[model samples]
Target: MKNSRSKPFVIGISGGSGSGKSTIINEIVERLGPEKIAVLHHDAYYRHRPELSFEERTIINFDHPDSLETKLLMKHLVQLISGEKVEVPIYDFPQHLRNSKTKKISPCQILIVDGILVLNDSQLCELMD
Candidate 1:
């Protein structure tokens, strides 16, 4: 038996680089059906540094929590929980910048937020149930 409420059950998946976080997410989605879950990757919220050259951006330490726009991610999560549509930002890894387009995410029954720093943010932690 599972909870069938309107509000989603947010699952925070955190781990080190190359630690199989996406593998775990894939398994969850496979079992739960992708339609029932909305996946939000913290890496997608990486701070945009268009002013920097490709070489400079490539040299930046992406491991630091400061490298991500976590505040915006938190806001999107809050909005989703409130049953509102949110335009999730897309990061262009190769370009090292946020893409001009956003993924429009609708409210869902399960919101799975995955990233190395997902659980590190106090506000984000409070919002997950």
Candidate 2:
């Protein structure tokens, strides 16, 4: 049941907070089968700012694209497309910082990237199929 394609098909989903993007993604994953797809959340890529206190981090505008480490995400996307595994960052929502642990994701036939500002980045948009 593995994907036979040489490269995974990348899909980017973007929307504002409280939107139905997550719901839509869930439906798609359910219909397509989760085993055949890999999902990357932009929220998980939030920059790890250890120097900033929890209060300071909370004050930072997370809605801005600058708050995310898009470069790292881009690099990981490239690697996933190349059939390589990646250790994705785990963000602590309450603390507004990245946890020391990471989630290891394997390349799949379909790659779904979702975030509020995912499509806002020109370079990141270029990577989508």
Candidate 3:
């Protein structure tokens, strides 16, 4: 069913690496029904460094907020909230690079932004409900 509200109810989930963030998200999605929710993972927004070699990318601290394109994520969130669809980037963990293809995500009743740094950024926090 389509969301009747003008904006989705945004929820931000954050935790350390290896934490149960994804687990929690999965459970929530299951209970709430995936068809009524949209999930955006911060890890999927890691900055694409095509110029850097695989070795160099590996050395970079993936945990650091600078390693992600938070600005783009924020923009996408805005678009989603505005009842627009977004093309989410696909990141390859093994190669430490963004995949050529993107996943199209539609706005839904609930928007779950999952990542360790989701709550770290003040601007991002402001966007959450």
Candidate 4:
């Protein structure tokens, strides 16, 4: 479904590592107030590879777009746009796996998706406003 005018204005921020995506998002959040916007980090959606050891996971190139679970992120975005609550996955960067805990994200007036490869996914890009 398409996002309606009453729904949140979704913004996808895509850039390389240390490219100041967070800086930009943070600035917007500061001006808009934390309660006015919802932030989703793409790194938090990394695929859970529990079968691999920490060493093996460390060797994996997270820089690759495929390293993230883009599909799940897209699903969550859909739910958010539909005015539904979503349980966003929490990732353990040091362990290279998704943690059991999840963050409950509610619908907001503005949604900011911050990540390195957000624009690379056609479906996700199409869904963004």
* Clashes (N, CA, C under 3 Å) per candidate: 0, 0, 0, 0
Measured with C-alpha atoms, the lDDT of residue 11 in candidate 2 is 96
Model 3 global lDDT (CA atoms, 0 to 1)? 0.95
Off by over 4 Å in 2: 1-4
Task: Give me candidate 4's TM-score against the actual structure.
Answer: 0.94
lDDT of 4 by residue, 1-129 (tens): 233578889999989989999999999989888887898899999889999988899999888877988999989999999999999999988778889999999999899998989998889998898
Q: How accurate is candidate 2 locally (lDDT)?
A: 0.93
In terms of lDDT, the poorest run of 10 residues in model 3 is 1-10
TM-score of each model, in listed order: 0.94, 0.95, 0.95, 0.94
| Winner on TM-score (3 vs 4) | 3
Model 4 error, position 50 (Å): 0.5
> lDDT of candidate 1 vs native?
0.91
Q: Candidate 1's residue-wise lDDT over 1-129, tens digit each?
A: 275777888889999989999999999889988888898899999999989999999988998989999999999998999989999999999889999999999887899999999989988898887
Across 7-40, the per-residue lDDT of candidate 3 in tens digits comes to 8999999999889998999999988898889999
Q: How many times do residue backbones clash in model 4?
A: 0
